[model samples]
Target: MAQWIRGWGQRGWAAPAGVCLCLFLLLTACGQSAPTGEKCLNCHEGIEEISAAHPMESFACVTCHGGNPQATEAEAAHAGMRGGRNPSDLAVLDAACNCHNGLAETGQDHIHRVRTSLQTTYAGAIAQVAFAFGAQPDPTARYGMLAVTDDNITTATGQPALELFRPGPDDSPMLHRFADNCLFCHVGGEPLAQPYFYRSTGCAACHMVYDNDGLYKGGDPTIDPAEPGHAREHRFTTAIPFTQCNHCHNRGNYSLAQMEFLPRPDLPDDRPLTDLERRELEYYQPIAQFTLCEWKLDCIDCHTNGEVMGDGDIHSSKLEVQYNQCQTCHGTPDALPLLTTIDSVDHPAIRSANLNPNYEVRVGDTVIATTRGETFGWVLWDGQRLWLTKKVDGMVYEVPLALGTACQQKPDEQASQYCHECHAYQRTVAPLP
Candidate 1:
């Protein structure tokens, strides 16, 4: 005790005291040992589905979100919180995402990818508009040729590079319209109107799901409410459902399936839709007659993280992104490898599939190790039966793929086109009663 006092005295009393105070604040901020039992945790303890990487004991609420961890009162505790409820906002990304600095192999380094993504920047919109006005050579040309350094004014293309693309001043009217109306859905733009659609730009766009009715109760946190609603759960999970993706994918004019241009005279607002009307609104032309897997499975079931989040490469269009075809899973006509034996497993593909927890191995099974030495034991199939699992909810399904039955498609010759040939509603008929 005497030696400790002497050490402090040598370093100057005030400086030593300040150091001790900083250390105490850091410990408290991380929720190591809070005198009042971690005020944030007191309210949020009910939400047990936080990411496995971020445990409550080691990573406190205040560490990523700036707030007064010492404050006992609600208002005071949330006073200086950055990005409000969304930590994935670019403003707070540096502080919140420092942990992912070295996790490129696991695809945790998503901050840089989102910043440069065509979906976030609307680079495709810019390129198309520029090409329409003869400013660029091709509509399919890359955004890099335009030389867009910031949010506004591309330097190399679109009439006068220095000024804003507006009607009165600029030569390109189409480019001006794109800049005015079409540019707001990107990363830094305003939040969506629906509370359930409240996803932050960059990382949170895909990972988080804000249940407004259950969590916010009355209003969204991104928009100020008359009376602030209690946030029920911070649902951050890799197992994203198709409904969560419907807001952007289904409601937009530019859909991946080109369904926006299709004729839909059935939907007249102000009345609840009938079953047929709902079906028409939901599915596109050929997609309406797709197999059960198309309707039952989540988007992430087929499209892995590297395809969606990106492989640290800037793509001009969604088509350019890497994805799995039907052949990748079901196999070619000549060969169909059943994932029963350890030697038969497609190790690289299986390792890639296991990136998300939804496709992870079941709790207790024979662990199949990848070539990179990561082990996974969840068996999706044996030699005889296919043990398929749904990604949205952990529901296991076993189906027989034998020949000379109602299912005419042979297991050995299963392809996407082959499955669609017989499984489509138009081709299928009811069994004789």
Candidate 2:
């Protein structure tokens, strides 16, 4: 703490000594740690809470991201930091394990789950590409970008382990092409440093949002606004907008033969784009049959924590873990949706509500849960109808349950592809006016 006070000016803390002394006394009286209250704040004075749950006043920068907060210079201060700057990077995620890393059914296992999820490993993509090129015997995953092991294999599809995918001299050229081109799409690596492709590594890639241009738009005077490839702010959120997901998922296509990523043509920056036009490009391919709910709600609304993050298991394909079906929330003609009340404070669903401020998750409130027992905030029942509270904006929509509606949805065929038979959206783009 003493060394931090001495080194404050090195990071551009050019305030008067009297003001600094007064600030120190105020922080001490208010019961904040001297180092967190003054040192990093000296340069990042106007920075707001990373999130309401993780107030900047409570957490020191070094708590999640290991660094010498007491050091007198940038090089020395950042000497032992995790993942360079982004602690969420899977390569060095253990640094922030105190809060997020776990192997149990506990909500804290997010980091652990994501580390093994198909998103990080790109297991399905790799396995398919290898199989297509005759590099692998079958489409079932034998390798992934990162070598992962699940000691507790609870599911039938779960693999005991996966080796780091390394193609040999005898391997197909397509395998080498996959290794070169498609690997960057996974969360294990930072994304492209271009517009519409800006994001961080690992968990931060989703939780922390980056603008299409990837500039820091927050009030931190120390950060550079002109800098691209940075999250818009130092905030983490569960209420991730669709745009954040679009950074990776909806951006473009890949050519297996050429082993290359073919970015979709950029919307002309020459003119101000329309919302309809932007939504068309941002969410859908040229002719997608998405439902109204799919367009309205943020990606996180339908895709719960369990569906997005793995269940501490390694799997060959996302289809094994991606169990968020259209009928999961909306029940079939045979019955209403299966509902569970928040029975325990320690229930993982509570954390879902706490992280997102869209709705209150309380005991005795009838809410929907996935077939795998994972629940999210909002989308609750009021006897008359089920309500879906949008995550990005607090827009409430009447969840159309198929209990009495004219629907012939079979129990076995509830995947999204089945829903599009009747509920598909066809968006017509009015030529940019």
Give the top-scoring candidate (TM-score). 2
Q: How far is candidate 1 from the true structure (C-alpha RMSD, Å)?
A: 14.4
Candidate 1 local Cα displacement, residue 64, angstroms: 1.3
RMSD of each: 14.4, 10.2
- Enumerate residue pairs that collide in model 1: 368-376
Return the TM-score for each candidate structure. Answer: 0.63, 0.87
Number of clashes in every candidate structure? 1, 0
TM-score, candidate 1, is 0.63
lDDT of 1: 0.48
Please give, for residues 59-82, the per-residue lDDT of candidate 1 as tens digits.
Answer: 667766778877777798889887
lDDT of 1 at 272: 71
The list of candidate 1 runs beyond 4 A from truth reads: 1-38, 41-49, 72-76, 139-171, 195-198, 211-232, 254-289, 337-359, 362-379, 398-433
How much lDDT does candidate 2 score? 0.74
Candidate 1 residue-pair clash tally: 1
Over 4 Å off in model 2, which ranges? Answer: 1-38, 266-270, 273-277, 408-412, 430-433
